[model samples]
Target: MKAPFFLFSIVLLSILSSCGSNKELQERAPAQFNEVYYSQTENGLNLYIPVAVIQENRVKLESVYFRGMHSALNLDAEKPNLYVASFATGKGDKIMHEDPKEEYGNKAPQAPKESPFKIESDEAILVFKQNEKTKYYKLTGIEERN
Candidate 1:
């Protein structure tokens, strides 16, 4: 009985110590993108990307739109064409119309009418064609303002 109890105590202690180490690792981990973009539109599409995600070549967009429309958009690292994706409106997230998935059915989803740009760096860039000329808008991290 004493031997079993001693072994159980040792295992429990090891498990507890490992758990504490994991928490410390998470807390000390460096952020991928120090700053995030805040949506000025009604959809409230704010995206946060960590440095690790970018390094891993996997981009994840987090957003919070109204009742309708999709708030999240992901660009897989394996697919390069997806990087130069389009959007519904030239304006901000608020102007976006209904989600293509709901309208055309998930089977035949429509591409966004407007192609934003191919995200390849820390900054998010939006390219627009104005008066037969191309314009660029570089999105900076919101935290940088502070």
Candidate 2:
């Protein structure tokens, strides 16, 4: 009888300790961004913009899509700190790559022909607005995935 009681008390203590540890872990986790804008093109391109990026004004886009291809106009910002542009089609979403010479020939790099959104920073605030209402998100540092 004594041995059985001792084992039951140990199990209860272990369960309580695990529950406390889980709560602590959740509190330490980073906060997630809540704002997001979902825009799609007539062809198939889809763009998802975070409100933090707009508040930070890191993006400057003229149109969402042009000739069935997603445009990366805001990517032309000069001396941008950390600008990330992502787009998706039927395949999947992908981060836009900035390759000056690869995409363009010897001629000077020109902005995309069409754009719908623009991102610019004024006093560390993102200046982005659209005709339609969109959700807002919290700004957080970029995380690299392995």
Candidate 3:
């Protein structure tokens, strides 16, 4: 009787708590971009986001979160309203593999360390600061260029 009622109350509370925390998803981002694309270079990957407009001047772009990594973003001085992020390739993964002594002395691999390089993919997350508040915006439909 009471046990089942308490279990149901706990489940209901958890669902409500999770739903209340995602307020940002319900709000719209106040910026616009002309296009978002990525190009592969010999050095690495270059992401180009041409800004059509930002809702306010106080909005400062911090970094671009893609795949599972975050890369710094900066405005291009040569091009107007263009924000770019460059990620170097050829870097090895974050996993660390220990060398085996004699042939069979290898233990389990160590936990992975987060990589500094960004992941090249179609979807990106734009992290920015507006009015001293940090927020995130999802950017999809990113085109790949040669």
CA-lDDT, candidates in order: 0.36, 0.34, 0.71
CA lDDT for candidate 1: 0.36
Per-prediction TM-score to the true structure, in the order listed: 0.28, 0.21, 0.61
Best of the candidates, TM-score: 3
Per model, how many backbone clashes are there? 5, 16, 0
TM-score of model 2 vs. true structure: 0.21
Tens-digit lDDT track for model 3 on 11-118?
999999997564352156647888799887655678898988886678888887665555799889999789998766534233344643444532333223333333
Q: Any runs in candidate 2 off by more than 4 Å, and if so which?
A: 24-146
Cα lDDT tens digits, model 2, 28-97, are: 1121233323344432332333323333343232333322234442442453432334443434333344
| Candidate 2 C-alpha error for residue 33, in Å | 3.7
Candidate 1 runs further than 4 Å off: 25-35, 48-54, 57-73, 76-141, 144-146
Best by lDDT: 3
CA displacement after TM-score superposition, residue 49 of candidate 2 (Å): 13
* Model 3 per-residue lDDT at 83: 93
